[model samples]
Target: MAEEFRLRSVAAVAYGPATLFGLAEGAILPVIALSAIDRGATTAIAALVGALIGIGSLVTNIPAGVLATRVGERRSMLLAAAVTVAGLVICLVQAGSGPWALVLYGAGVLLIGMASSVYSLARQTYLTEMVPPHMRARALSTLGGTMRVGLFAGPFAGAGAMHLWGLPGAYCVGLVAIAAAAVLVYRAPELELTAEHRAAAASITTRDMIKRRWRTYVTLGSGVLLLSAIRQARQTVIPLWAAHLGLSPTTSSIIYGVAGAIDALTFYPAGKVMDRYGRRWVAVPSTIVLGASFVLMPLTGGAVSLALAGMVMGFGNGIGSGIVMTLGADVSPAIGRPTHIGIWNELADIGTGIGPVILSAVTALAGLGPGIIVSGVVGFGAAATLWTYIPRSGALRQARAECHD
Candidate 1:
C-alpha cells in the first residue's frame, strides 16, 4: 500500500537534489550583494542588484509552472541548472564599472533567481507525482527538511571557501553545488504517468483547471499567503527587535541560530501529525503559536527574553514545515498540477516578498514594536483564515481522514 511505503525509499531521488540545490542557493545569498559591491556598485545599488534574484523568482513562478508542465519536472531542473551555471560563469568573469557591468550583474542574478523558481516548482511537482496522498505530508516535509538542513549548513561551506579565494570562491562553491545537483537529477528516473494521469492531462486545459477551482484559489489561497507572510516575518522581526534593544550583532546571531536549531527539529513530527490527523490539527495551533510568539518578541527586554521569543517563534514555524506545500498538494488536481501549484507557490512567494516590506514600513511610521505586532496580527489573521477554511477547502483530505478513522 502507499501508506506502507517507507520515507527512506526516495531519499536519493527527492532529498539529495533538493539539499544540493538549497545549499547552492543558501551559499550564494550572503555573497550576491557583496559581489555587487565588489563589482564597483555603491551600497544602495548593490542592495538593489541583490534584490533582482528575488524579483526574478517572483515574476517567473507561474511561467515556471508552464515550463514544468510542458517539459516535465526533471528536464525543467536540468534547464534551470544550466541557467545557473551560465549565471555563475558571468558572475565569475564579468568585471568593471558602468551600465554594462550593472546590466551583466543584474542579468546574472536574475537568471539565477528565475532558475530557482523552476527548480522549486519542479521538485514539488516531482514529489507530488511520486508520493501518494496518505504519506505525502511526510514525503514533502522530509523534502523541506532536507532543503532546510542544506540551507542551514551552506553558509559554513561558502565561508570556508571564501577565506582562501575571496568573493569568487563563494561563487565557485555555488557553481559546484548546482553542477552536482544537476548530475544527480540527470541520473534519476523520469516521472511515469499512469493511464489515469494521462487521461486527466488530455482532458483539462490549465485555464479550465483554474476555472474549476477559482474560488479556492482566491479564498483558500489567501490563508496560505498569510501563512507565508508570517513565516517570512521571522527573518526581520527577531533581528530588528534585538537591535532595538541594543543587542550586538554577534548576540543576535546566536539567538537567531538557537531559534533556527529549534525550527529545524520540527518537520517530521509536523508532517506525521498532519498526515495522521488532518492539516487543521497542526495548522490552526501552529498559526496561533507563531502569531503569539511574534506578539511576544517586542516585550522581551534583554537577550535572554529575546532568545525565548525567538525559540517560540522557531517552534511555531518548525511545526508547520510543509503546511503550505501540503495544502497545495491537497488541493491540486492530477491534471494541470504544475499550473495549480505554480499559482499556489506564486501566492506564497508574493507574501514572502511583501512581508518584510510591510513590517519595515510600519516600523518606520508607527514604531518598531508596532510593526512586529502587525505581523502578529497577520498571523492571527492567518490562523482565523485557516481555521475557517481548511475544512471546507480540503474536504477531500477531510473525507480521507474520516475514512482512516
Candidate 2:
C-alpha cells in the first residue's frame, strides 16, 4: 500500500504537464481552427493542424520508447520536459504570420505528443515496478482519474488565459504548466534500473520485443480505434452541433469542463471496480457509456440538454478510458514495459489526430446527429467484445499465469 501510494505520487507528478497542456492544447485547437480559416485555409487545411500533430506522434512514438529504455525513466522524463518546453517556447516566441506559425504549432504539438509518449511509458514502467499486480488496476485507475481531473481543470484555465491574453496567453499557460511539471518531476525521487531489469531489457531487440508483446500491442490498437472514433464525435462534432444550436463558446467550454469533472470523480470507483472485479468488468461499462453518450446527443435541445449530454458523455469517456489505460499497462511485459506502453498510446495519438478529419467528413455528408449516432453504435459494438475477452475470471487466470511466469 505504501508502495502503491508512492507510485501514485509519481503518476500524479508525471501527469501534471499533460493536465496543464491538455487544457492549453484543447483551447488552442478551436483557436487554431479559426485562425487557419481566418488565414484563408479551407476546411481541409484547418483540420490539417490536428493531423500534422498526429503524424508527428506516429513518427516519434517508437523512437521515444527506445530512447526511454536507453536513458532510464527519470532522464527520459527530463528530456521530454525539455522538448515540450522548447516547443511551447517556440509557439510563444514565434506567433508570426504565414505557414510558419502552422509549422511551429505542428512542431510543438508533435514534441508534446512525443514527450507524452515517453512520459507515459516511463511512468507505467515505474508504476509496474513499484505496485503489486493485483493493485495495478486500482493504481492505474487512480492515475486515470488524476488525468481526468487535469482534463477537467485544464480547459477552464486555458479558456480563461485565452480570454484574458489571447493565443499567446494560452501558449504561455501551457509553457508554465510544462515548466511546473518539470519542477515537480525533478523534485520526486527517481527510479533506478537494477542489474536484472537491465539484463532483461538488453536481451530483447525492438523487433523481437514487438513480436513477443504483440497481443498487448494489438489490443491497444483496437481499443484506440474504437475510442478515437467515439472521441471524434464527442470532441469535434458534438461541440460543433452545440455551437450551431446557439450555445456560446463559453457555455460549450463549461459543458466540456463539467464532463471532465465527472470523469475525474468517477476514476476512483472505477479503479476500485477494476481492482476487485478486474479490468474488463470496469472497461466494458465505460465503453458502453462512451457509445451511449453519442447516441443520446441528438436528444439535447438546450443548455440544460447539452449539459446533460456532456455529463453523460464525460462519464462514459472517463469510465471507459480508465480501463483501457490501466489494462494496457497491465498486460505489457515487464522487460519491455516502456516500449510496449509507448506503442499502445501512440495508437491513441494517431486516433486522436485522425479523428477530426474523419468525423468532419461524416458531419459534412450526413449531418451531425446521424454521424454521432453512428459513432455511438460503433462504441456499443466495441464495448460488447470486452465481456467475451476480458471477463473477471479470465483476467484472474491471466494474472495468476503472469505471476507464475
Candidate 3:
C-alpha cells in the first residue's frame, strides 16, 4: 500500500493541470485593478472592478457543482478552460479600448472567475473519488502545494511578459497557461461514474443535499468558514500592518515574499503528519499558531520583528493546506460528491470574501490593532471548531482502523 501511495500518475494527472490554472490566475490578479486604473476609473471603482472575480466565483460555486454533475469532471474542466480562453481574449482587447472598456474588462474577469469555480470544484471532486482514504491528504496537499508553486511563479511570468509587450501581454500569458491546462484535461481519461452519479441527472438539488448533511455542515463547515476567513484576512492584515509601521513598499514586498517562502515549504510535511498521526495534530496546532501569530503581529515594532510574525502566520497556514477540502472529502457522500463539494466551497468562499470586509470594517471603527486581534480571535474559534468536530467524523475512521490493527 505504501508503495502504491507514491502515485506518479496522480502527481502528473492532478497536480500538473492545477499548476497551469493557478499560474494563469495568479498572473491575471494584479492586472484587473491595473486595467481599471488604466481606463481612467476612480480608485474606489477600480477596487470594485478588481473584486468582480471573487464575486463571480462566489455566485457560480453551486452552479459549478451542477455543471460538473451533468457533464462529468473531465468534460467540465475542458469547458472551464474554453471559458477562460474566451475571457482572456476579451481582456487582451479591452486594454486598448476606451475608458468604458473597464466594464468589458470586468466582464472578462467575471467569466474567468466562473470558469475557475468550475475547474477547481471538478478537480477536487475527481481527486476525492480517485485517491484512497489513507493517501487522500497527501494527494490533496500536494495539489495545494503545486498551486502555491504556480501562483508564486505566476507574477514573475506575467511581469516578464508585460515588460516585453504591455498590460495585454499579461492576459496573453494567462491564455497560454490555461490553454495548456485544457489540453492536459482533455487528454486525460474520463472518471468512471458510479451508478449514483448516472442517476443524479439534475434531480439532486442543493436543497436536498443540505437537508441530509446539515449537521456536518454546521459543525465542520463552521470550521472551514472561519479558517478561510482568517486566512484571507491575512492578505490584507500583513501588508496594511507593515504600512502602518511605516515600512516602504519594497520592504513590504520582501517581507511578504519571505513569509510566502515559509508557507510554500510546509505543505508536504503537514500532509504526512495528517495522514500518519491524525488531522487533529495539524488542525489544532495550525489554527492556534495562526491565531496567536495574528495576535502577535501588532507587537512587532520594525522590519525584523514583523517578518518573524509573518513567518509564524505563514507556517500556520501552510500546514493546513487543503484542510477544508480534506475534511469535506472525508464526509461527503459518494452519491452527491459534486453537490456536497459545491456547498462546501460555497461556505469556504463566503468566508474568504467576508474576511477582508470584516477586517476593513473593524479598521475603520476601532483602528488596526483591534482588527488584527479580532482575526486572532477568529483563529481561536477555528481551532475550537475543528477540535470539537474532527473526532465526530473524519478522525474516527482512522481511530477505529488503528484499534482494529
Of the candidates shown, which would achieve the greatest TM-score relative to the real structure?
3
Cα lDDT of model 2 by residue, 26-49, tens digit: 545445565555445578877776
lDDT string, candidate 3, 247-303, tens digits = 999899889888887888899888878887878888889999999999999999999
Query: Each prediction's TM-score against the native?
Result: 0.93, 0.86, 0.95
- Using lDDT as the measure, the top candidate is 3
Off by more than 4 A, model 3:
1-6, 95-99, 392-405
Structure candidate 1, residue pairs in collision: none
Clashes of 2: 0
lDDT of 1 by residue, 6-107 (tens): 565666567888888778877888898888877788999998998888799899888888888777888998999999999888887766867788779889
Candidate no. 2 TM-score? 0.86
Spell out the clash pairs found in candidate 3. Answer: none
Summed backbone clashes in each candidate are 0, 0, 0
Taken over the whole model, the C-alpha lDDT of each candidate is: 0.84, 0.67, 0.85
lDDT ranking of the models? 3, 1, 2
User: Where does the lowest 10-residue lDDT sum fall in candidate 2?
Assistant: 389-398
Per-model C-alpha RMSD: 2.9, 3.1, 2.7
